[model samples]
Target: MTGTIKIDNAPLNKFHLKITAFTFGSNFSDGYALGIIGMALTLIGPQMELGTVWQGLIGSSALIGLFVGSLLLGWLGDRIGRQKVYLLDFLLIAVASFLQFFVDGPLALFILRLLIGFGIGADYAIGPTLLSEFVPKKYRGSLLASLTVMWTVGYVVAYFVGILLEKAGPDSWRWMLASGAIPAVIVLLLRIGTPESPRWLISKGRIEEARQIVKRFIGPNVDISDLIADGQSEQHSTSFMMLFKKKHRTRTAFGCLFYFCQVLPYFAIYTFLPLIFKAMGVKDDILGNILLNIFLLIGAILSLWFINKLSRRTFTIGSFLTLTVSLLLLGIWPHGPFILVMLFFAVFTLVMSGFSNIAQVYPAELFPTEIRGSGVGLTNGVSRIGSAIGTFLLPISLASLGLGPSMIGLAVVLLIGAVISIAWAPETKDLSLDEASQTPESSSQDVVSSSPRKKMSSH
Candidate 1:
């Protein structure tokens, strides 16, 4: 048999599990921030006397900040170190949360949300990179995908908190919004003093540090000479432009397209689900959030099981197609009865849950250690623009064009995403990150050289 793949084929350990949870806490905070904001807006809108336009701005302010954070932090992480940027972002998140409790006006709250989004954006870039770098290839997909589970759990927790505090008088919204700080603080604590990624260290030419990381956490007796060789071959400096280089161009396009396709509709619908529930005749906001999250969580769990079984390309395309169908049904009858609306939303959430989980996993798989942060960060940042635009305009669309047209538009976006996924997304299942991130030309050469027939002749 061919010798085992050294770099990515290492065995896993407890430290890996611990760090994975710590990293996952970032996604939990992200989910909480987005989830709590929706309910808080319903309450805060009237208290602050905000209009539709201002509500939309408040809704999208963090996303706008996220756009900047993802790009800037991703670049920074690669230049400095993942550990440094990752920890600092959570601090920003904590400070932003505390400041939000003091908001007396729309502008103050919006600016605070924008600052929170900045930190979240950086987490988006740095967190996944840290996770992917530490985990062995065998467990990487599921472990990385578990962030979706954390996100769903966080969302549910926030909803629970919102419901519990709903009867706490007019200031309940403050409690809901400010509560996000707790999780961020916990994440900061959990990740404190954790080592930087070994893969990243190798990419930076710190072979000794990388070796210690591999030996201590990755697996004992796992050789990494090939990994170091590959890291040495890659471009060392960090920049978004690195993604556009010939080797990474195709993968970059795939990652961005994958993110934008789902997030555009995902944010537009899920971020404003509370409002959408009202439009659909769901009288109890608390009940609606709990019920909707149940199916959403179920879908996320299903995706965890299915991710390893299904091809990334096929699952993504099918999810978009399914989402398109659900949106089409909603567009056909936007004001349908409660049962009909619930059915459509259930389908939409299920599809969205699967897609979102896979989207994060793919980005970590597509880029090499050197540019992984920048690659995922840039695409994530770019897709945040899509999310922001979609969310900012959804309210306007609902008011002017009616919910029918908005659903139709989301359907169109899904269809486009499906087409792109079918055309470009590479198969990443069963491959280690290094193996998966290799350029097509390099992979082909490795395939030819590792042919069984060549090995047989040598023997």
Candidate 2:
């Protein structure tokens, strides 16, 4: 016995990897649904003759739904089991997508999106948290980062598909909105018999059940005796207020506020990328979306590579600075030629690619097994408010203040995110979920029982 007895020693097997792939469907669907909105809005706004407030609501409404979904599903996952809450969300997404296809007006569209948002909200809260719980700690950071890539991939695919279908006429947007049902349906169908998070079972005091799950995941060869012992360390249940306790309070603040600052500007800028381009005289909406999604994919690829390598604070703070500078350039030179705007815009997308990747990992990593879903859900809920504010107000901001001022305002929000990252971003590169969430006293008391690294590799 030489190293810490963290949960990493549990086998990283095919079953775990399969779970990872299945979880991708949710993130992919989320990206597709949300990304499609920008294009959908561009078409619908004129047909409906929408006002600024209505435009804002339509854009932000799904995000509002996300907050509601996160709160409800997140708690439900913690109370019930992650798999149960996980499987049902995709059904909700499919239903909402179909409803969105038939909806007549902004009000109808808004309600439908809210329902879709709720489904996405559950995925946002549960996907990463559950993935982190299931995977080996050795690959947790990289594997979890892949969820963001899957999201970007879905978004990029939606944009490309939208471009092809542009010839379908104004009705094309409805088709685009409805398209998400395909993957949601696919993910749901694929999730048949997805296993419960053994960690959740352990948290619920079902020690024997957790043991059986560990054996299946790690293979029958290895003994999970100590693993079960380590897991039982968690108290039987947790309340929302417990997230506010001293041990976890700081992480909660960091989780909620950091995401708030980042998404505040991120959503505002990206949600309105088309409008921003249109105002700058870039006429081809399809080309504009293609470039944005391409750059976004490139950024996500870069993020996928760098997430494990970069220091958390350095990465987060640097990304915000990059976003701030790129956005500020757009604001300062409001009328810069297309190439200049495109260059800055591409640079901003590239920077956020990596940053946003880590942003997804942080909340999932911040808390312990007992409340990971609820905690991440709450933080994401806060992010939705930020997104809602940005989305709901961006149209008004662009109209009232023009491109330069709106971009500058967004840059200011990114700056605030940089500051928060500097102040609070925690380094989580190779740490176990349990290790990352350990209180100071707990860390001191729960000394390593053996060479956890050696033990983890034994099987």
Candidate 3:
């Protein structure tokens, strides 16, 4: 069970931060590419002479790709390894982005956009899982929480790019879309120097290689003597079905349900923000979209500050509550003053940011290393189903119900999310990935079984 130990003076926190930063950078690039498509769709649609239905179809093409990719590639990451799949995904994304430059008609653009979505969907599942596996227990939550920071950076970059591209004229949108290829190139290059997950290696019985990778981070001198688990001698391989085994089924279901609820309302609100603003009498679509991105940036920044300060469960619940109230207000008074509309948008951004920050970290902590990737991927894949439904149905709902009723419907969904989160999600603020994976049922049994059995002697 024991392995070679290393010791060093550098803080473990510093190493974790570096690893997180690298992963974050890669994700930032992927997210920027994805965000731009959503932001620029309005401008690109009409200039290309697309009708309402066609516009919706073009915009949703990427999401359709994402929905499929998340399930297939996410499962692959779990079955093979995170690093290998991640590197391959970056390459695919680069190719997709490069091809986007050549899109001339609706069918061509739709296909290219769908490929880009596939890359994004794969990255979404693998990136966070890689980052979470590499960090130490003490800083895991905050370190993993930082993925949202990268996501925001991408969104901000897209926001400015959208504004600039709008003025860049008709041909300029092509360049703006293709510009996303640059980051993919960078990530592909940078990831070549990165190591595979040490824990994954160890679980797969490649102890020496795992030790070498761990040594790179913890320094050559630090003692991992106490960190290695006795169970390393035992096999730890897992399959997708293992997630639903007797001991793990409830945990897997909980994780999947939480992710589903998290995305249901969040995507519903986000995908329709511009439309909602227009309904509220904001005639300028570009301006409305830009403002939405700004509010999203503000929310992302505030989330970084509060995510580590509060309990994961508390912050998540509070965020849902905040979103619920904002949606309620917006629903009740769709034609309110500009200031009130802006207020709701701002609050919506803030709460959604908080929810997103916490939500990404939660799944990474929910399963053992053996099944962590599968568990996260499965949950995320299921969540994408909800997102697909939201993306497809929200505009239709808005069309029929008006902005007010649409907001109210989303508010009710968020309320349901808040209730489910409070009931089933466990607190995992400071626990290590492995410790958090240990089921509550097992822990309770340990407590009960260890109690003294001296009743006969007393009688």
Candidate 4:
């Protein structure tokens, strides 16, 4: 009976699927909320008489709100609990989404979308952190990678929904924005009784509670003994400052930088796909966007397999380099033949989808249970800053720099991401949670199988 349970190699079970379903829904809601606005804006801009500045504000506001939500609530999730915050944030998203249907002005709509973004941000911090802790290492990479696919599906679905809703009438923009409530509400119900992470429980020294939950939900023989031993050092501060401390600073930098680089161009390009298409001289912007997004969705689906097949470092670095090349082609030949333009856009979206998939898995794996939420949140928050900036400035850039130069700028961003990946991306494939979270210097020790070291608590 002693030390018999080892979650690192445990087989997939029903509980794992349940957790994945709940987390998947959250990412789906996020993608829908963020993507719907791009199309809605085409209608809202003229109907509401919004200029580029207001449109940019309205477009980027949710991303700005994400920055606030992740930095604050992500830290709070660590102190409180994941399930509590998970349900709370969904309530916020659902309420904000429904409120959008009643907005009379651009300012009101902006505020509502920002609130939705805030809720989505909180979920971003919690969902992967929660799911990653519960999933066995055997399926962890693919399971977590699947979230990005859900997100892409949600984003593509938003476009399809937007196309249909646009035919509903002048007020259709209101309904389009509010449609985000549907997914949020559904996920909220799905998460109603989800359990807290046993790792979080163990980190907080509720060892008996952790053991009982793991036994009941996971299995009686699944061992959390090492987790219990690790809990003894639970005095590590969950403060944001701790992320910048010597032990975690490298990971913190890589997580934030890589995420920021990937999303800056992603939000910038995809959020205005129609506009980019028109600028590129595409005759039917709407149809072109749909096909391009389909390619994006395909890339996300493909990454689920690639994540396990290639080392994380190799996949990430290669994805970025490929993405950079795709964008550079479009940049250098802004008015390329119709087929070439479509091909470049398709390549960029496809590569970007796989590159962005890392965002779901890498940040959560960077920190221990005590601050996993915070670590994920901090990276998410920083990345949103990049997203917000790119979203807000894209229109302005297009107006001044023209589409060709703007494409070049985005290509440069991807090139920077490739360099950063080469410099710092860690290979986390096949590693257990304990091994993945540790710095390279200390990861040689298989702490999960080793005898507990004797130590006195600071407390």
User: Candidates 1 and 3: which is better by TM-score?
Assistant: 1
Local distance difference test scores for all models: 0.82, 0.79, 0.71, 0.85
C-alpha RMSD (angstroms) for model 3: 5.2
Candidate 4 Cα errors over 4 Å, as ranges: 1-3, 440-459
How would you encode candidate 4's per-residue C-alpha lDDT over 1-459 as one tens digit per residue?
565757666678899998898888767876787789998999999999998899889989888988888888889999998889988898999999999999999989989888988988888888899999999877888888888889898899999999899999999989999889898888888888898899999888788888888888788789888888777955767777888777777788889999999999999888887778778888888778778888988899888888889877788889989988989989999898888888888888888887778889899877878889999999999999999999999998998899999999998998898888777776566767876787643322322122121111111
Model 1: per-residue Cα lDDT over 27-62, one tens digit each: 788788777887788899889888878878888888
Tens-place lDDT digits, model 3, residues 236-315: 65777888777777667767776777777666566555666677897775666667677777777677668778866688
On TM-score, the leading prediction is 4
lDDT winner between candidates 1 and 3: 1
Each candidate structure's TM-score, on Cα atoms with residue i matched to residue i, is: 0.93, 0.92, 0.88, 0.95
Which stretches of model 3 miss by more than 4 angstroms? 1-10, 13-15, 222-234, 284-291, 442-459
Error of 2 at 34 (Å): 1.7
Give the per-residue lDDT digits (tens) of candidate 2, residues 80-197: 8898888999899999898788888999999999999999999888888888887777788778888888878887787777777767997888898998888888989998888788
* Candidate with best lDDT: 4
**Lowest summed lDDT over 10 consecutive residues: which window, candidate 1?**
446-455
State in Å the error of residue 200, model 2. 1.1
Candidate 4, residue 185: lDDT: 86
